[model samples]
Target: MTLALTRDELAEYLHEVFPQIRDDFAIDDLSPERITMRLLTAERHLRPGGTVSGPSMFALADVAVYAMVLARIGKKALAVTTNCSLDFMRKPEAGRDLIAECRLLKLGRVLAVADVLMFSEGGTDPVARASMTYSIPPA
Candidate 1:
């Protein structure tokens, strides 16, 4: 499908719909099938060992997919996560932002599925992975 929203429009819509997380994520890139997002890691995003926290990584995965959906479908803030499977692998590198690369596996009328791979900024290996399914709002 063609894009319903451009990258800038998607970013604006995300900020309008989710002000609470607006500062935490940045849309680095966008395409028809994939989105690249960055988590602006801060002290609050780190664990005791200074690595990015699991919950923070999960948030990146969640928002990245959500953004991807909105980019394709336009402003559907009601779309919600119906299911998620997440795996934490290695510790994230210290003092760097976290990056999540997400691809939409399915974008049906009622549901959307996304696969995400997360890594510390500039790192080659993934630190976490997630698969998320979202329930799209009926038109």
Candidate 2:
């Protein structure tokens, strides 16, 4: 399948919608089936236990999937997360940045589904996983 938005396009859209987080993540890879997001790790993302915070992981996964959706459907900032289930499976590396691998499960006009696996940079195993559904505002 042809992709409507490329990595550069996603970055531009991200810059427009979320100026704060635009500096936090970068589009590492974009494909018809999936996307990879890299977090620019910082002190704020770490927890007291020397691990990445759960909220940070969740945000990474959420934005990663959200960006993947926008890549296919174009700018739709109103598209918001309706439901999400995240599993924190393991400890994350506090010193390294995070990576989110997002796969679009179902993309339609009103609703979309995507799953994300988050990994600590320089690691292969997923530290957390999330499944999210988005509600696309009516045009």
Candidate 3:
């Protein structure tokens, strides 16, 4: 399906609907096939060892999929995660932003599934991987 929201429109919608996390993420790229998201890592997102925390990575993964679903299905802020499986693979680099690449595995009338790979900025290897399923609200 064609994208229902452009990158800017999606970003704006997210800011409007989720004001609490408005400053935490940026949409780096967007398309029907995949979306690239950046977590603007700060002290609040890092753990004691100066690496991006598990929770922060989870947020990135969750948001990336949510953004992808909204981009395809229009501004449905009520869509919520029903299942998430995340794997922390390696240490994220210090002083670097975390990036998540998301691809929708399936997008149906009531549900969507996505896979996400997260990496530190400028890194080739993924620091984490995630699979998530979201429940879509009825129109």
Candidate 4:
């Protein structure tokens, strides 16, 4: 499918809808099948051991897929995650940003499915992987 929103537009829409997390993520790239996003990791994102927390990684995955869906379907803030399966493969590198590469698997009328791979910035191996299903709001 063709893009309905550009990278800048998606970022703006996200900031408008989710102001609380407006500064947490950045759009790295946007494409028909995939979207790349980065989470600017900070002290607040870390756990007791100085590693990035699981919830922080999960947020990256969720937002990456959410942005991908909006890129193809336009601004639909009501579209929400229906199910998510995440695997923490390895501990994320400390003091590094996290990158989430989200691939759209299916974009149906009511449901959208995507897979996300998250890695510490500049890392070769993934730190986490996620499969997510989103419930799209009717137009």
Candidate No. with top lDDT: 3
Stretches of candidate 4 exceeding 4 Å from the true structure = none
Evaluated at residue 86, the lDDT of candidate 3 is 98
lDDT of 1 by residue, 1-139 (tens): 6889999999999999889988899999999999999999999999898988888998999999999999999998999999999999999999999999999999999999999999999999999999999999999
On a 0 to 1 TM-score scale, where does candidate 4 land against the true structure?
A: 0.98
Q: lDDT per residue, candidate 2, 48-130, as tens digits?
A: 97888888888999899889888888888988999999999999877898999999999988999999998988899999999
Superposition error at 76 for model 4 (Å)? 0.8
Q: Residue-wise lDDT of candidate 4 within 1-139, one digit each (tens)?
A: 7999999999999999999998799999999999999999988899999999999999999999999999999989999999999999999999999999999999999999999999999999999999999999998
Candidate 3 C-alpha lDDT tens digits along 1-139: 6899999999999999999999899999999989999999999999998999999999999999999999999988899999999999999999999999999999999999999999999999999999999999999
lDDT of model 4, residue 120: 92
Q: List, in order, the clash count of every candidate structure.
A: 0, 0, 0, 0
- RMSD to true structure for each model, in Å: 0.6, 0.9, 0.6, 0.6
Badly placed stretches (over 4 Å) of model 3 are: none
